[model samples]
Target: MLAGKRILLIIGGGIAAFKTPELIRALRGAGAAVTPVLTRAGAEFVTPLTISSLAGEVAHGDLFDLTHEAEIGHIQLSRAADLVVVVPATADLMAKMAQGLANDLASTLLLATDKRVLIAPAMNVRMWEHAATQRNIATLKSDGVLFAGPTDGDMACGEFGPGRMVEPLEIKSAIEAALSDGPLKGRHILVTSGPTHEPIDPVRYIANRSSGAQGTALAEALRDLGARVSFITGPASVPPPAGVTVTRVETAREMQAAVQAALPADAAIFAAAVADWRVENAASKKMKKDGSGALPTLAFAENPDILAQVSQMTSGRPALVVGFAAETHDVQRHATEKRARKGCDWIVANDVSPETGIMGGSENAVTVIDDKGAEQWDRMSKADTARRLAARIAAALGAS
Candidate 1:
């Protein structure tokens, strides 16, 4: 898929940099040329000689090299690649990129580059979640930078939770996607997935049976079609896919806020099973049994109608807005009503009756409802369903 491509690979200073030699081989095996830039710190984990040997190109390291500088090699290197990829994009490096800092060879080349850049972040969990790092991430996304992963896993720091660099193969896939010229190229799609948790107390909340399989699959399908995907997900049983920007939220209110922040998208898909109501006066601490037969009374408030709000928007609305309806009965009628009531372009409805096993299952039977009416689809794997839906979305947006 990457034949004849030129990749400017920047290996950053992180333990994950040790994986770049393998990545270089993978890229080369796919018929791409790799020009490596080894950061001073990156050299601590892997030698420039090793990188140069694997990539079959001189691993550029010094911005002040007399011979290279005389010819403005940095400018030449920056503009020569089809795509620039940073493996183990350290927090410091990301901050530098976000701020347009060019104090070194890597940062300088990044600033000089006219190519799309894809970064795979690796850092301590706290650093990944730090407010400053998150701000930098938001800035980078706004600047049209692509991201692979800082997925949740056991970290080299002996800690866990969302700071591990994605595996080399995943990075390769991301590279392919970054360079793809598919139908959805240059389009930004917003996808909401999983089950929102509405807090009832410090330890208790309301949620659904949604496993987020279909949503995750759909996001990946759209990503493979070259769409820049903004994935706003709730607490899900399945992890969010790589190669997409992920915004994690817990409640319907939080999801609404995240969706709003990810706006100006070309299309939006609302697939989350958000709670309809939340405890109005949730306790600050865990509620106690008190050894009494009576149960604690709870007041409920309706959650925000995110689909309706976005669908009814008078301005900045997505060209296509698709919402999901998980029903127990009368699926078609209720979903049809929902499509008109929400003002969305389409409704993908499915029966989640316990007997159907579709709520948290691997397969789905759905009816795609629109102004043209319902089109029932046979049960299939969530991945297949996603591909069909994504194709439909591509066609819809393409025609519009």
Candidate 2:
């Protein structure tokens, strides 16, 4: 699908830079012509000769090389490609790009590029979570730069958190989505995912078995279909999709607020397993375990019903509002009732009984219930289910 497309691949400094050769192979396998540009720091991790060998083209660098500048200057290099991608986008490189400081060839091409730019960030978890880096990322997103990965996993620094760069295959998929003429183009969708943590104390909280994989997969599917997605996620185990706008929260109330802020979408999917109650008198600090043989009384308060509120909106309701009913018994019957009660257009019903291992497992078997009735689906991978749902959504929206 990417036949004849030109990709400018910018290699940044990080441990993940070693994967650039594989990334080049993936892009080339997808019929894209890749032009590599290595940074001074990037050369420390991977040699320019190796990059050139993998890409089958001369890797470009040196901001003041008169001969190379005369042949294909930074401006031409920036404009020549359909997309500019940064693999292992280091914290320093991202900072420079965000600030529009083009002191080097890579940063200069980034600053000068009119074409769409995509970055796969790779850094230490602490560096990735730094306030300055977060601000720069937000700025870059606002400026319409695309991003992929920096997904959750163990990093090179031996700390396990969300700083690992996504695999090359994942980046290739994002590239295709960014360039494809899919069915849901120009549409906006809202997706909620993960289990909310209703804190009882500073460190203690109530949560569920939601891994957020299905929701993340669904968001990716929608993005692949060309929809602009607002991903409102709680404390999810899985990272959010590459191309969507993500709003992360911890509590049910915060998720509700984030959902409210992401308004007027074409569709809304409530895949989050939200908590039904929260501690009425949640402790500000950690509750002490005094050896007085006294058990503290805990009070509960009802949490906001996000699905019902959005479904019953008098104005600006999404064209389709889909809720998930994870039932332990009477799946179809309960899901049908839930669809009516919540006033949503559809309910994706699944059996989440402990024995089924559906809550955190990779596979899922769901029955989609709508006004027309329940449509039974075969057991499939969560990714497959999401793709089917996205296709259905496209058809429904098109018919409407």
Candidate 3:
């Protein structure tokens, strides 16, 4: 997919820098020409000779190389690449980019680049979770910088929890997605996934059995088709897909807020199984069993109707708004009714009765209901269902 693409690869100071040579090989194997830039701190971890050798290009360093500076090489290098990639994007390097600091060649190139920038962050757990680093990450994301991974795993610092750089293959996949020009290119799609948890106390909560697998798969499919996906997810067994902006929310209200924040989308998919009610007077502490055997009474409040609200928006509504219905009986009839009640363009209805094993299972049988009629799809893997749905969405939007 990346054939004839030019990638300006920037290596940052981090233990994960050792993986960049493999990443370079992967990019080159995909027919992308790599121009490597080794940071001074990155040089301590891997030699410039190794980077240059793998990339088949001279490793650039030193912003003040007199020979290159005479020709404004930084400007030339920045503009020459189709994409700029940062491997092992250190906390310091991220902060520099967030603040638009150009103290070195790599930073200068990043600032000067006209193309999209993708970063794979690697750092210790505490550093990754630190407020400053998180702030920098948010800043960079808002500035349109793409992130592949700093996924959860064991870090080189002998710690764990979301600071590991994803493997080379994953980064390679992300780069391919970034360079793709598919049917949904330039479209912004919003997807909500998982089961929202309505807290009853410090420990207890109300939730459903949505594993988020189908929603994750849908986001991945949309991403592969070159759509910029804003994925708002709740607590679920499945993880979010790579190459999409992920927003984590816990409750129905929080999901609603996140959905509002990711507005003006070309399409919106409401796949989350949000709790219908929340405890109005939830306990701050865990509710204990009373010796008197008197059960505690909890007041219930209706959760926000995200699908209905978004579908019935007066302004700034998405061109295509899709909702999901997990019904136990009369799936098609109920789904058709839901489409009208929610004011959504389409409703993907599925029978999730225990007999069907579809709710939290890997396979799904769905019927897509729209103004025309109900179109039933045979039972298939969730991944396949997602791909089919994504294709339908692409065709629908294209015709729109």
Candidate 4:
């Protein structure tokens, strides 16, 4: 996906800095020409020679290498790449970036760059979660700087939280998403993911088996195509993808409101397994399981149909409205009916019977139903399915 792209990788000071060599290799394998800029603190964790060797190019370090400056000015270096990537972006570096500090070579380049910046933050758990750091992160996000992850896991420090840098492969995926000249560029796409949790009580809720894997993949695929994605997700098992605006919701009502709020989008893909009903008269506090002879009876109320509502919009409706139908029997029939019932432009139907293992699994076999007819797609990885769907969406929108 990154073929012929030029990436400026800024390595910052952190134990995670040691992982940049692998990142460099991954980028190169994807055909991205990498230019390494090793920070002074980054040099402590990994040698400039190793970074340069792995990237197959000389690493830039000094802020004012007279000879280097003469050859390629700092401004030119900053603007030369398709994208700027900061791996192991330390808390200090993040602070500097947020504060517009440019004291060294790395900071100077970042400040001078006109290109989009993607940062993979890596720091101690406390440092990553600190209020100041959180504020700085918010500031940077508001400024339109992209971010991959400081995924939750074991960190170099003894304690663990959401500070560990994501693996090279994930970073590679992010880089691809960041740099791809996808057909959906400049388009705004709204995607809903995961199973909505309809609250039964303060402590418990009604939920589904959806892991959100498919929806996350679809959102990522759309984003890779350069769409400005508004990812409205439930409490999903998989983390949300990078390079998109993510809004997390828990219940069907909240999800509906969020979807409505992300209005005037070019397209809307409703992939969430939203609960059809919610418990009426839900308990404000945890209901005690008192040893009464009889069990408590629960009343049900219908939840807002987000997909139907969006599809049947009279004003400011999206150009494309897509819905998903997960059925156990007669998938095609049900999906075809659903497309008409919901007034959506298209319907993606898949068997989610427990026996099929497609509900929470990594692969999907689906038939996309549109006004023209049903297009049966063979079983494939969810990522591939999403990519295909995104392509179709791009083409359909282009034609429209």
Candidate 5:
């Protein structure tokens, strides 16, 4: 996906800088021509020789070097690449970029470059959660900057939270996405993911095994294609992409209201595993186990169907409506029937039976059913599926 692309890498000063050599190699291996820009402070963490050796080219550090400026100027270099990638995007660099400060060559290029910017932020957990960083990230996303990951894990500071740079492979994918033409650009897409937990009491509720991985990935992929994504998600195990506007809901009804509020979308993919039924009469207080000879009888009531509601809208209905089918038996048949009943354009069916292990699992095997026919895909990582689906969406949106 990154073939023939000129990737300008800006390495920031952080412990995460130790990962840049691998990133440089990853970019080159993916058939991208790499240009390394080392921040003055970045030099302390990783040697220029490492970057030069991996990229097979000399690295650039100083902004005022006469020889470097005379040939390929900083301004020109910044705008020359198809994409600008910031690895270990430090909190300082993020602040500078957000505030339009160009004291250094890196910041100057970032501000002056015409190319799309992709940032992989890596910092301490506290720093990441800090109000300033969050504010900067929000602003950057609003400004159309692309961000890959800051996966949650142990940090160099010896504390764990949410401030870790994404792996090189993930960044590579995001870069490919950035370089690709905006497929769903100018389109609005609404997607619901995860499992809604219906409260029966203060301490207990009904829930499903949905990881929200597929739906979250779909939303991110849509955003990568330049679509404006509005996400209505139940309590997801995983967080949604930073760029997407998300509304959190706990029950099927809450999700429905959130979806309806985000109307007039160009398309919607209902991937949430909404409960078919909730306790007809939920306990106002926590129900305790009392000395009883028999178990308590609970009555259930049906929940509203969100997909059908959105797809069957009389006014301002999206051009495309997509639904998900998670079934243990007769998967494709059920999905085909669902497409018609729900008034949707597509049904992405996946078997979540215990044997499939897809429920709350990272990998998935999906069969897409539409008016055309069913196309079953080999079981692969959910992230890969997201990429393939995003490409198809771009194509479809283009034709539409």
Candidate 6:
């Protein structure tokens, strides 16, 4: 889908640079021509020769190379590609880019270029969330720059939290989505993802096995289409997408409240695996295991039905309301019934049986049910599912 498109890749100094080789493969597979640019500090993490080998072109460096100037000079390099991508965008590189400092070849190329820029940041979690870094991120967003991921996880530094670079496949999907036609521009979207943990006690809670990958990916895809997104997310394993307003919640109640406040959105995708029931009477203190040698009977109460309420809203109602149905049996039957019961426009159903393992795994097999009927998609990776779903949403929004 990205044939004839050119991507200028700027590698930065960070541990995440190791993923660049796979990124090159994915980009090439998508039919985008890749050109490599290495910063002086970037070379410390990955060699120019490795970049040159994968990109199948001489790596570009130096502000005054006679050969580069003979053809693709700094001016040409900046203006040549359809998009400029920074993998492992380190703290130092981001600082320079945000400030428009051109002290190195990579920064020079970026400053001189006018292409759409995408940065996949990777760093120590502390560095990523530092006030200075956060401020720089805000500056970049206001400047209309794009960002893919700084997904949360155990970092190479042994600390766990946000600030890991998005996987190469994730970055590739973002580029493809960006290059696709912008039919969904000016549309407003609402997406919910991750698992909501409903507290029963100080140390325990009710939760699900959602990683929030699918919903987060959907948010990125929608953003690439020029849609404004209000991403209300539950406590997720991944950091929220950059450039999107993220409302983080820990329970179904919080998620519901956040979603309602973000109303009048053009479309709503209820992808979060919200807990169905919460402890009716949560203990103020940790419940002691009594000598009775009996387990505590936890009373459960239904949480707010976020999807149904939004679907049935009267004031500032969204044009589209999409809900999710996770079924272990009768996937089609349950999904069809859910569409009607929830009063949603559609239901994306999946089997979450332990044997299927689709709940927490990266791959997904979903059957979309609407008034017309059901369409079962072949099992695919969640990232691919996100792209396809994004395209479908774009097409539907254009029709409306």
Superposition error at 41 for model 4 (Å): 3.8
lDDT of 1 by residue, 60-170 (tens): 999999899999999999999999999989999999999999999999999999999999999999999999999999899899999998788998879999889999999
Note the clash tally of each candidate.
1, 0, 0, 0, 0, 0
On residues 1-400, what C-alpha lDDT tens digit does candidate 6 reach at each position?
6788999999998989989999998888778899999887788888999999999888887878988777758889889898898997899988988999988789888788877788888999999889999888877755656677777789998999889787888788667755655777657789999999998899888888888988988888887777767788888887677645566789999998888766768999999998889999998899897798999888889999988899998788788889989899999998998899989998999999999988888899999998899999999998889889988888888888
C-alpha RMSD by candidate, in order? 1.2, 3.5, 1.9, 4.0, 5.7, 6.1
Query: Against the unseen true structure, what C-alpha lDDT does each candidate score?
Result: 0.95, 0.90, 0.92, 0.89, 0.85, 0.85
Off by more than 4 A, model 6: 25-31, 53-58, 62-75, 95-113, 131-145, 152-154, 182-189, 208-249, 253-266, 276-286, 292-319, 325-392
User: What lDDT is obtained when candidate 4 is compared to the true structure?
Assistant: 0.89
What is the lDDT ranking, best to worst? 1, 3, 2, 4, 6, 5
- Tens-digit lDDT track of model 3 for 1-400: 9999999999999999999999998889989999999999999999999999999999999999999999999999999998899998999999999999999999999999999999999999999889999899878877878888777898777888878998998888888888889999878899999999988899999889999999999999999998888899999899788877777889999999989977879999999998889999999999999799999999999988999999999999999999999999998988998899999999999999999989889999999999999999999999999999999999999998
lDDT for predicted candidate 3 compared with the true structure: 0.92
* Residue pairs that clash (backbone atoms under 3 angstroms), model 2: none
Question: How many angstroms is residue 258 displaced in model 4 relative to the true structure, after the best TM-score fit?
Answer: 5.9
For model 4, residues 1-400, the per-residue Cα lDDT tens digits are 7888999999998899888988888889888899999999999999999988889888998988998788666788899999999998999999999999999999999999999898898888898879999889878866767777767788766888778888878888777777767788768889999999988788899999999999999999898888878788898899988767666789999999888877879999999999999999898988787877677779999999889999998999999999999999999999999999999999999999998899999999999999999999999999999999999999999997
Query: How accurate locally is residue 196 in candidate 3, as Cα lDDT from 0 to 100?
Result: 93
Q: What is candidate 1's CA lDDT for residue 87?
A: 95
Better of 1 and 4 by TM-score: 1
Clashing pairs in 5: none
| Cα shift from native, residue 274, model 3 (Å) | 1.6
Q: Measured by C-alpha RMSD in angstroms, how accurate is candidate 1?
A: 1.2
Task: Determine which window of 10 residues in candidate 1 has minimal summed lDDT.
Answer: 287-296
Which sections of candidate 1 miss by over 4 Å?
none
The clash tally of candidate 1 reads: 1
Give the lowest summed-lDDT range of ten residues in model 4. Answer: 141-150
Runs in model 2 lying further than 4 Å from the true structure = 64-72, 153-160, 185-188, 228-232, 235-248, 257-265, 284-293, 309-318, 328-343, 351-357, 361-381
TM-score of each: 0.97, 0.83, 0.94, 0.78, 0.70, 0.66
How do the residues 172-203 of candidate 2 rate in per-residue lDDT, one tens digit apiece? 87787777678997788899999999999999
What would the per-residue lDDT of candidate 5 be over residues 1-400, giving only the tens digit for each residue?
Answer: 6788899899999998998898888888989999998999998999989898899888888888798788758888897898898988999999999999988878988998988888899999899889999889878866767677676789877899678887777777677656656767667788899999988888889998898999998888887887767777888899766555566689999998878777778788898999999998889898877877666677899999988988888998888888999999999888899999998888999998998889898899999988999999999988888878777777776788
